[model samples]
Target: MSAEHLDDIGARLAAARARVAAAEHDAHRAPGSARLLLATKTVPLDGVRSALLADAAARAGDPAAPAPVLVGENRVQELVAKAPHLADLAPEVHLIGPLQSNKVNQALGVAGCVETVDSVALAERLATRCAASGRVLDVLVQVNVSGEETKHGAHPDAAVRTALDVAALDGLRLRGFMTVGARSSDPARVRAGYRLLREIRDEVRDSGEPGAEGAIELSMGMSGDLELAVAEGATIVRVGSAVFGARPL
Candidate 1:
């Protein structure tokens, strides 16, 4: 990336972080309660590094800045392709897209977390892979709160049960829930979807089942509806276009 391009990315990243901070305040949550995860889909490796550098610079300048921004990719192939190059940065990479059963082993080799475990079968595959590798993988159950046919996640009605089952697997650690939110023009409708996710998370955490105590994260919200998500108690917001600009068509 050219110096100008890098500068633009840095500026955009700063703006995105500011938005998250403002949303957290508006929601009456602690200043840094909601974390930002950079969704790096279709972004080149250089651009990814630039964003990470920008976050590092922010932390170096302010003691209270959040830890290195988390990185998430929407494809196993992308995660496999970019992870090796980003290994030196020690980024916390997450597989945020659908995971094919055949690719579970490949995903385990790269991603530190899998945020799209939508089915018990998929979770079982991941567990078997992790056990063979002798490593426990952190994961979040993806809930289809919007009931969208296009989305891939556990149905809203079955999310809690799926989460509990995933938690029981030996090689996986349930870290709460994740959702894409409802796609709509009406803010209330969108916020309702996010709110439902929070309710499910709360229910799971209070269930007192083995391994349920640690399921506290709510990875909802994105560039467009981050504020609404924060208002609904999101613990992590995934931002992409607002930070990296629109991907090439």
Candidate 2:
């Protein structure tokens, strides 16, 4: 990255940290805590390195400050390319992208948790891999909460069924549901989208078919409107630009 790009990266990282801190303070604390995932899809390797370095520096100064929580990658290949650079950075690495059946093994190699377990085929693959590795994995049912025709999530009507199948597998723990809120800036639509995800999470818990005990976590919201999601019951917020600034094209 050019020096100018690096400077921009630093400023964006600082702003993101500030916003996350503010969000943490605004919401009523829930249970042990809410998870804040740093969406790092478009951030180049240099920027990621810079951000990680900054996180360490911040922690050295104030232990209470978060160290960019969990980092998520939308693509397995991108994550694989960047994984070595991030090996010592974050403890929890999430694959928030759509999972192709053929790529499940690659995702398993890098992602600590695959957040978009949308299909039974993919879930079964993950179950097999984790089983062979003698490890249990965490996953969320990605629901098409926005009802967008172009979105890659499972249809809202089918999400719970898929979640049931995924959870019943021996290797996967059905953590909860995740959704991308409607993109419109209109607050009402975003809230409604988040509410829909929450509603499904509640229904699945009530049905008791997912085979998980304890409260489910709703992983919704991004940098744009995470506060509203928290208001509606988001247990994990996936934020990117609000933390890292505009994505690098």
Candidate 3:
């Protein structure tokens, strides 16, 4: 790794540690709640390898260990490329990017959680793959709360229906709802979007569906808005650059 890359990772790690500390001190929060899933999309395997090694070293002597490292990827190719070894290192491997029906089999090969189930066709494909594999795949419905055309998630109002449909699939477990907030300098919009997704999750829960417990996860956050996400009941935060450094060109 370049010296500059090391510096970038050091700074990001410090920031993540700081965020954890703040989250711990936030007494208004639940006793045991919310989790971080560092988004590793577009990041090389080496970067995650380095960060996990460092984290393990730092916690060697501590009695209360830090949370287990969780990794997320945004694309099928990347997940396929880096998952074999990482499967043992990371407790969870989430597919936090857009997924298509054609890629379900590949996704099933590596993913522990598919966090961006946005369509009926893709959901059915995932279930079929899971059934064939004799595995019950966990999944999250991606909600486009911001209504951005460029975004890949479904609209917030449609998230529940989509999630329930996926839950009904033979071998799929509707694990939760996830979303990527609109980018902004103020951060309020992003924060609001996180809250909105959380509220949507609760609504789905209150529906008394069979998959409610399995689908309680609300994954909404990245490096920039993770704090806001945690504050607003984000069970999974997919932080990329903030935990890992800038991607190599």
Best by TM-score: 1
Give a tens-digit lDDT track for model 3, residues 5-41: 7557756765786685576457366533666677777
**Model 1: residues >4 Å from true position, as ranges?**
none
Better of 1 and 2 by lDDT: 1
What's the distance in Å from true for residue 53, model 2?
2.1
Best by lDDT: 1
lDDT of each: 0.92, 0.78, 0.77
Query: On residues 174-207, what C-alpha lDDT tens digit does candidate 1 reach at each position?
Result: 9999999888999999999999999999999999
TM-score of each: 0.98, 0.87, 0.90
Alpha-carbon shift of residue 205 in model 1 (angstroms): 0.5
Clashes of 3: 2
**Where is the poorest 10-residue window by lDDT in model 1?**
59-68
lDDT of 1 at 24: 85
Report the Cα RMSD per candidate: 1.0, 2.5, 2.2
Question: Clashes in model 1: which pairs?
Answer: none
